[model samples]
Target: MITGELKNKIDALWDMFAAGGLVNPLEVIEQITYLMFIRDLDDTDNVRAKESVMLGIPYQSIGDYKERPNMIGMYKTALPKDVAEKMRELLQWYSKQEKNLTTLAEFHVRYEIIHPFQDGNGRTGRMILFREALKSADVDPFIIQDDNRSSYIEGLKEYREEQKTDKLVSLMQQETVDYYQQCSYFME
Candidate 1:
């Protein structure tokens, strides 16, 4: 919740990125990585802004939220300006959705789109999705693994682009079946 003069300064920095046509998330990260390399090679290491304090929570903002401008393929995540409000809306909406595959997929999709955290958005969202699955009746929890990564991205892209969840729901269905089979095997 950075505000006042500090927020303005942060906004100015983002504006500079926009002015330089660095809208792509990967490009921005690349530029920042170079800056980090240069900083590592230099002796000017005492000038970091003291505003942010890391609390060892990957899914949360530090002292205040910062945007990393994340993207998945062509889809840019929620805008930096809308993070707080959108996150509020997401939580509110999350509290009321029907706890099933449709809602679960939709919830995961929306969370990925919102992408509130600077880092760990995907992992955090998947964790929440799995938890939500546990809460739902008859929906065995399953992790979104690297093996299903393409389908996961495709599902997200479909919903983001076309307002559809069939692919996502299908993926969840298969994952749950797999989870149940594994559980049965272990029990046997």
Candidate 2:
């Protein structure tokens, strides 16, 4: 069950994303992905800090975003050094982009590859994607039925292996276009 506090946090996050001027579903999701990554890192560091006597990693060893040029260092606290560097590069590349539909799509492609969340990454990413879609594209989020899960995962796999984003992007585009058309028809 969703607690009231958690519900409020989600609502507040959506509002913050909207205020940040990221209306594209992909852009919003990407922004949220970064924030979530930072939050998770802080949480993990807090846990590690309590056990610092054994881990030998001080809580204060965690890099502050204000001191660092990028968050690659923060995420590194949890990820392998090499993986963290790669994700940091991707995040920096994407974060510098201006808000646009193309950037939104690119964000979706890159963030999925980073896969920063230990769990709930896919679901949370999709939620941001949906909200951004509603705000920017006027498209409602469509559910991917259980049977289609394999295809979705396969598309993401191709992206990671080959850097090809066509399959997933096309699927999202088609779903959004289809939903918009259906809604338009109903209104007519």
* Model 2 CA deviation exceeding 4 Å by range: 1-92, 98-102, 137-147, 181-188
Q: Which candidate is the best by lDDT?
A: 1
| CA deviation > 4 Å runs, candidate 1 | 1-64
Question: Candidate 1 residues 1-188, lDDT tens each?
Answer: 67899989867876788899987543454455456545643322222222233433333332244455777667888877888898899889978876778888988899888877665567667767766776567666766667898998889989988999999999988887776665553233
Provide the global lDDT of candidate 2 against the true structure: 0.57
Candidate 2: Cα lDDT at 95: 63
* CA lDDT scores, all candidates in order: 0.71, 0.57
How do all models score by TM-score?
0.63, 0.45
> What TM-score does candidate 1 reach?
0.63
Candidate 2 per-residue lDDT, tens place, 34-72, comes to 577668766866776688767775444344322222232
Model 1: number of backbone collisions? 0
